[model samples]
Target chain A: MTRRIFGVRTLGLLGLGLLLVGSYFGLFVAPAERYMGQVQRIMYVHVPCAWIAMVCYTAAFVFAVIGLWNGKPRWDARTTGAIEVGAVLNALLLVQGSIWARATWGVWWDWDVRLTTSLVMLLLFAGVLALRSFVDDSDRRATWTAVATIVAFVDVPLVYFCVRWWRSLHQTQSTPETVSPAMVLPLRLNAIAILLIAIWLIAQRAKLERERLRKEQVDEPARVTAGLEVTDA
Target chain B: MSQERKRRRLLAVVALLIAGGVMAYLAFGGIGENLVYYWSPTELREAGPRAFGASVRLGGLVEPGSIDRQADGLTMRFAVTDGEASVPVVAETVPPAMFREGIGVVVEGTMLRDGHFQTQRLMVKHDNQYRAPEDFKPEDMKELMKSLQFEETGT
Candidate 1:
């Protein structure tokens, strides 16, 4: 328990450190936009949320695959925990994107390619979580969830490319080459910070889940005995 | 050498293969083409000479007195000029609600196989400025400024 707490605390500090650096440059040092003025500041938060959400879902899918293959309780818990965190951040990205769009594009919502693809991803993961609630057998649940995760992972790149494939008015990516050097640093830092924060959230959630499962193991004699008997046999 | 461990390893490899296959196809195989087009009037003009007969964006200020509304005001032909280069555009569709003769506009179409500019969509560029309702009244604004004890600090 002490080790687990220490692990989570360490991750929290790393996340905070990254965020502090990100904000320092993003808010204070970066130059304002030539056209949009101060409203360009929204990119620091909106873009980072989207990038981190994708990273979280990718991590969740990896853990889901691990859990299904090995039938491990720890991996299963981590997969589910990451999925929950990813879903929250996905929703955050959608809201922030909408706000940014309204300020820049003069419209709150449009059935554009990127937006549609993101909504599809959100619904697919929501279905994954809902599917979890319907299953009682741990192994079967993990396997099915892993399959669903793999299928859903296919949509991440699709969402990224939706705007290009179709005629949409949304802006293209701000890359190192495209953006000014001063803007690039803060944008990159904010993205890294968001990714770290996502990992920290997943670690904390996974730890809590481990503790819950640990308690169940201690309280259920039948499960413990069955495990011991199987090992001995 | 345990049977369970071997099975787990095999399953993991299979899962990895599936993931690799899907990601490879999506990322490198032209399966994902979602990219949003963002362009300024300057960029459009720069691309004009080289973009012969190809579809591209044209954005600029709508030339005043150049808008010709058809029988239905919805279908209009206008000329967008960057003060140096101008293109005559025919809007096959209705113009956006905010579109006016003087504001900035962006049209998506090709500089025809000929030289005529034909557009499939017309979008009005939105400016970023907000003034409070109280500030809408000039007299009230002056009184509010006087009450705040503010004076001009610069020429």
Candidate 2:
């Protein structure tokens, strides 16, 4: 357990170091945007958070599929951890998006397709996490969450394609043809840094979940024995 | 597994499928109805009375020399053009700082009966280029760094 903690800590520290370096380059080295000026620096963090959140959700979807197929507790633990981290990052994405919107769009929130669909995705995953907590039986919880995650994942593609399919206020996807090389460097670096952090967080969370499961298993026999004694008395 | 367990599993699977189908239908139906939240001037013209008084977003470039600030500084009028068609816009709020002539913009409002768009929200669509201002020189960066350092030192 200590060794696992040490590994996660080292990964977290590496992520932090990369984040600091990426922030320095993003803030001080990258040129200001022609229109948004310094406010555009937020994109370095915002885009990364959004991407990592989506990636985490996608990982959770895969874990859900695996858990359902194999009925493995480890896969279920991974799905839960990924969903928690993804939801946190999703909330951060919304907040950061709101800030950027206020600066660029002259409004904090809009009912545009892109924004609305992303919110729906976040809410759906949040519902899955809530449902997981409400159920007590581990196997039942795993089965239900796996099913919910699969259903919620339908929104992922919608969120990605919303800008293309509808008349959205939000800008379309950023690509090499759109962004400059200097800007891409910081964006890429920050994305890598955030991805590392997300991996470390998910790993630590999954480990904690496994430890809890172990404790529960250890107590199950004692609990049954206690119940038997009570019934006998 | 017992026969009862198998029956329950089958029922659960069937329920999930039905739920997924219903959700997909509702989601797609909503998207279809709201697909075109905004219309270009050409599309608006084609829609004609159908678009009148309905809340919609209009996106295009701001025509140069067409911006007119009303008696109140907050209210402004401008014409949005897509190079093929133009729509006059009257907005109640101040335009964003990036709002300017020839720049891309998306205005959300209702189309009045008199062929004008009444907007309460204005958004400036900036291009993807991240470059310093034309006037910004490399030497200015040195001074900027120095000032930043001085501020950090509270000197």
* lDDT, residue A177, model 1: 50
Off by over 4 Å in 2: A222-233, B1-34, B127-129, B134-155
Positional deviation of A97 in candidate 1, in angstroms?
0.7
Lowest lDDT sum, 10 consecutive residues, model 1 chain B, at B146-155
Q: Assess the local accuracy of residue B67 in candidate 1 as a C-alpha lDDT between 0 and 100.
A: 88
What residue runs in model 1 are displaced by over 4 Å at the alpha carbon?
A215-233, B1-155
What overall lDDT goes with each candidate model? Answer: 0.66, 0.76
Q: Can you write out model 1's per-residue Cα lDDT over A30-136, one digit (the tens) per residue?
A: 77665555667777777888888888888888897777666666776788788888899899889987876666555566655678879888999898889977875
True contacts kept of each: 0.14, 0.39
**For candidate 2, lDDT tens digit of each residue in B1-155?**
25434543554465457556855764565545446655667777788899887788887777878999999798899998765688999999977777877666788899999989999889876544455565332333233222212111110
- For candidate 1, what is the DockQ-based docking class? incorrect
What digit string (tens of lDDT, one per residue) describes model 1 on residues B1-155? 25644665666667667877876765566533333243334445567666666776665667778989899765778887655567778887765445565556667777764556788766554332222222232323233222211111111
